[model samples]
Target: MIPEDILFEYNAKIKAFDKDEKIFSENEIARNYYQVLKGAVKMSNFNDDGKEFIQGIFYKEQSFGEPPLFINVPYPANAITLSDSEILILPKERLLDLLTKHHDIHLKITENLAKRLYYKAIIASEISGQEPMHRILRFFDYLKNDVHELTSNSSFKIPYTRQQIADVLGLRVETVIRSIKNLEKKGEVKIISRKVYR
Candidate 1:
């Protein structure tokens, strides 16, 4: 569990947003970092053609926006709630103060950043291979590692839509749908009432 002192020290507060609401816009100053208390948030960027490509999906209990906070720059991607969500917001000044006072928290932040970098590297490598099925599998593997209870027999509740999944995986929506169908046909996965069970 996260420490209450940390929350207090950072002057954090729980914030709520409705579905399809923008948490932060691209090029907006990174004023605060947010941790999802419930639901999902997607980080995305618009291409020259004005098509949005998802950088990632952050689920409940996961953190986002810290990288830009330390860099003193606008957010590289826009953050939007996938559903109604509760988030804990830690403002920049308070976070810096906490880092100055708590070595352990600083270490934890560094560790989290390192892990994200590692996952990004793996994703980049898979993308270069241009195999949509492999990309989807790799994404599933990452999510399974990050969130507990996601396994062969576990119900993997995907918080994102098919188009969102395709954007995140850098695959065509048709290909993503086909891959999901293949997995279902092989009995490797099942979609029951829109929830995926593996």
Candidate 2:
């Protein structure tokens, strides 16, 4: 993510979005690069059956929807604010100009894009063939590792609701709830105070 001072130097603008606001829809032409300055954003989509699939959830300092900027393609998923948030936006042309001048930022963008791609690949693999229990554990383990907070059999929290977790895993909320409880009973995880820990 670009630092605040760098954004200032670029004259990048910040905009506020209310909770549940749609920042952009699937297939929208990508015109700007965005980073969350506060709150959260989720990139998601609904299939023909109206089943929601969460591509990813992004928090402060995280950038989303930038692949479109680089590829000159429309967004593959919709971005919506998970809460009232401030977002930094740099126009595509300005971002390209800045990248041309700042090799470090360009590398950072590459790293960010790589991370997203890796995550999507992992999720796709998990969803396609894994059992519910394996899928649940692997998914939470992935989240924990991403935060660099993994510990041997120690507990950690996933910053998402059961429904959100289900959406991301392409499972029903009830299935997620049942999976978590089963995992807990099997000593693989614990659901304390209605929050998941593993």
Candidate 3:
């Protein structure tokens, strides 16, 4: 993520959004770079039956929807605020200019995008045929090591809800709940006061 001061220098504007507000829709043209300043945003797509499939969840300092900006294509998913949030927005042209003048920032952005691509690839494989427990553990491990950058085997709390996990892994809510409980019984995870820990 670009530093706030650097973003401001690049003509970025900070905008606020209410919870559940749509920042952009599927197929919308990507005209700006968006980075979270506070709260969370989720990128998702819904099927014809109204079942939502979560592409990803982004938190503070994380950027979303940049692949389309780089390729001059429409966004593949919708971005919605998970809570009342502030986001820094920079026009595509200005962002490109900034990147050109800042090679380090450009490299960081590329690295961030590469991590996201890797996560998507791993999740795609997990969802195809893996058991529910395997999928859940893999997802949690990704969050612990990659997203949160924690290395210890000590407890790591999960930030996502069961429904969100279900959406991301293409499983039923009941399945996620049951799988989590089974994991807890097997010592793969810990649940205390209804919050999952890994």
Per residue, candidate 1 scores C-alpha lDDT tens digits across 169-196 of: 7778999899988877887667888666
Ten residues in sequence with the least summed lDDT for candidate 2: 146-155
> TM-score of model 1 relative to the true fold?
0.85
Estimated TM-score per prediction?
0.85, 0.92, 0.97
Q: For residues 78-147, could you state the per-residue lDDT of candidate 3 as single tens digits?
A: 9999999999999999999999999999999999888888999999999998999999999999999888
RMSD of 2: 1.7
| lDDT (tens digit, per residue) of candidate 2 on 10-127 | 8789999999999999999999989999999999999999999999898988889998888899999999999999999988888888889899988988877776687788889999
Q: What ranking emerges by TM-score with the best candidate at the front?
A: 3, 2, 1
Regions of candidate 1 where Cα sits further than 4 Å from its true position: 1-5, 147-155
Top-TM-score structure, candidate number: 3
On a 0 to 100 scale, what is the lDDT of residue 178 in model 1? 92
- Angstrom error at residue 105, model 1: 2.6
